[model samples]
Target: MAASVTRVFVSHLAGLPVFDPGGDQVGRVRDLVAMLRVGRRPPRLLGMVVEVLSRRRIFLPMTRVTGIESGQIVTTGVLNVRRFEQRPTERLVLGELLDRRVQLVDSEEGATVLDVSIRRLPARRDWEIDKVFVRRGRGGALRRKGETLTVEWSAVTGFSLEEDSQSAESLVATFERLRPVDVANALHHLSPKRRAEVAAALDDDRLADVLEELPEDDQVEILGKLKEERAADVLEAMDPDDAADLLSELPEEDKERLLALMRPDEAADVRRLLSYEERTAGGLMTTEPIVLRPDATIADALARVRQQDLSPALAAQVYVCRPPEETPTGRYLGTIHFQRLLRDPPFTLVGSMVDSDLPPLAPDTPLRAVTSYLAAYNMVAAPVVDESGSLLGAVTVDDVLDHLLPDDWRETDFEESEHG
Candidate 1:
């Protein structure tokens, strides 16, 4: 630690009030974001997520944060109002890293991470995680029987992804509370061998969710390392469109081999998605949208929308078809937005409330046209209908945005001066 540095434990700063230069309260610190480095390097402090007066969480970069002292945080008063979206290179300290199990580098003794300390770098605007407070014990930090010690970050061995199976399990346990995207972000920072080990430890459903968020290369690498049978299971668990996109990156023979191992129904959905152009509506649509029959009531629609597995865009509305409720459903009747379900009586039939004024997208619609349609109609998702007017699936705004952004966008680092 440098002479000018004053180490502050993150636990003490968790709910500290943040103020502008004028001393007006802006928000309270909800969580700190840090960028984990490869190997044993200390993670760099990125910024903190603050809950503002309106309860909207926003990113407050470290550069704009002038001081953290006197049980308060003082900033330059400049903040980005856009909701903070964690990138693949970042980690939420409070939410993910706390209470983790690690080991002492020299003694190789098991230890539990109680807290970590951050200090401003010498003669620079940067900050880094410098110290780790740990308890040497067989159980977690909650047990007071172990010897507590404060050590330099490098003195810890189990924090890195390259640790053994036990350590990997601890890492997985630490990530259990995070969203799939956050878990994928943490994985992106690990070495190939270690990344594969962690991915293997995750269950089929969890691994499928993580694979969807990972870049194509990482997805291919992790999937390649799994047993062929397991890989098929994971593919089956992923959304049909995402699974198809991943399969497209593999060699023709390998793709076919995996597809052959998958369940017939799941493979069929993926195969249909694969038949479309990579950048077309058919290629980007997910076959698992909320689908209902005309006779379904508003209550039924609301209940389907409440599914925990659905993405916000997918849950934003329900597609009403005639006979079959699944994709490639009977003649596409219309769609009912989520708001309509809340407005109408519970007994109202979804068929009578369908909003069919907006034309549905065709399977062959180009990606550019799909983008324009969503923008023009203020829709989060647009239905895809085949030549027979059978509902195929839906293309969501998030998927379109994923395709429209630069290929390396997920790996791009956020600059310190971004807020300044």
Candidate 2:
């Protein structure tokens, strides 16, 4: 092996472009494949899972790789277009190793695996797993600020995951830091039993976020598997619009049961959203956007917008309202864009900077009308009001686009993400 062959971490290698010896682009590296062996020996690199044209995932053996440089991998001229399948002896480094919880063999201290480094053996042309990177902190807090270190692969245990032996707890822990969409994708790839187990392991809020990003079918399936109280809690944790969307998929009886189980206020918001057509302004709106009394100071509005958990779309503006400032109960006044709060003196009342030039969307407005309203006004989110001019909710651009996209857009997005 060339001594100059560079070592790369699996996390960094993920999604890098791959090209053939002829310089023709083949696909992007999706995951690293390795074969588990006896004792503490590092697993040998089998190859990589490359997502090629047509979004088909195929395997490329390390022996066929000619170079790994910059952000791309170069392979020999030959290629196999067959779809990649996991053999019993193989494991995916990114999917199975990175972010997994493992134990320090000597001290029994627990660590969360962060990344794995791989390099070519000095005397052979083959590459194998080199060092395991892990994060550790005192106490049992797996996510607390911790020190990271690279140890030989033999220094750790728990790398071997037999197909039938993988536990849901570890799988959920491995995905704790991943985005909701990524977690949903990983859940989609698991077997039904494993998916249910993983879902059960996640807390209500985390499960709710993942459910929102999943397909309607998946959303219903996972929600259905939970016990009544737990399912209701998860639904309560979800955004009202998303909760309504998922409820719209359930049978009317099941819907009413779950609604009754939820807190009255949360249930009421979802019920109101459910009363509208699936594609209309009311259906696409979230009832939880920031709301402030006209008398609220710029500082107060700023404080609400600064909330760490507030969604960016909803946080972009604060709806100024009459008494009972909360949505669904207040009269529609005007909206105070976040920029106005920043430009005005902190003590200034929001009413003084309210933007009332643009009309609020009627609750029953059609989808096309909402789209046009947002586009024509260049707004990220627009407020919805009842015929009596009471504040209902706000329809965000992201929610509008979600309803407008093709039904299969999620699958298409997964394919496009391979190259991103």
Give per-model CA RMSD: 8.0, 5.9
Per-residue alpha-carbon lDDT of candidate 2 for residues 1-420, written as tens digits (9 for 90 to 100): 232665777777766779887788988776789998898999999999887755567889998988887768888868887768888788887766765667899889977777899998776669999899888743345645678899999999887744443345545655665678767876776557667878998999899999988877778889889999999999999999999999988999999999999999999999999999988898899998888888889999999999987788889999988878667847778988898789978999988888888799988899999999999988899999998788899999999989899876766655444443
Model 1 root-mean-square deviation: 8.0
| Cα lDDT of model 1 by residue, 1-420, tens digit | 223446788877766788999999998786799999887889999999886765556899998988887778889999987867889788777655665678898999988777899988877778889899888976557866688899999999766453243335545665676668667766775668668878988999999999988888889999999999999999999989999999999999999999999999999999999999989999999999999999999999999999999999999999999888787899998999999899989999999999988799999999999999999999999999999999999999988998998775555422112342
Model 2 spans > 4 angstroms off: 1-30, 36-43, 50-90, 93-119, 129-165, 415-420
- TM-score each candidate: 0.67, 0.75
Which model scores highest in lDDT? 1
CA-lDDT, candidates in order: 0.85, 0.83
Cα lDDT over the full model 2: 0.83
Give the per-residue Cα lDDT of candidate 1 at 363. Answer: 92
The segments of candidate 1 whose C-alpha lies over 4 angstroms from its true place after superposition are 1-166, 413-420
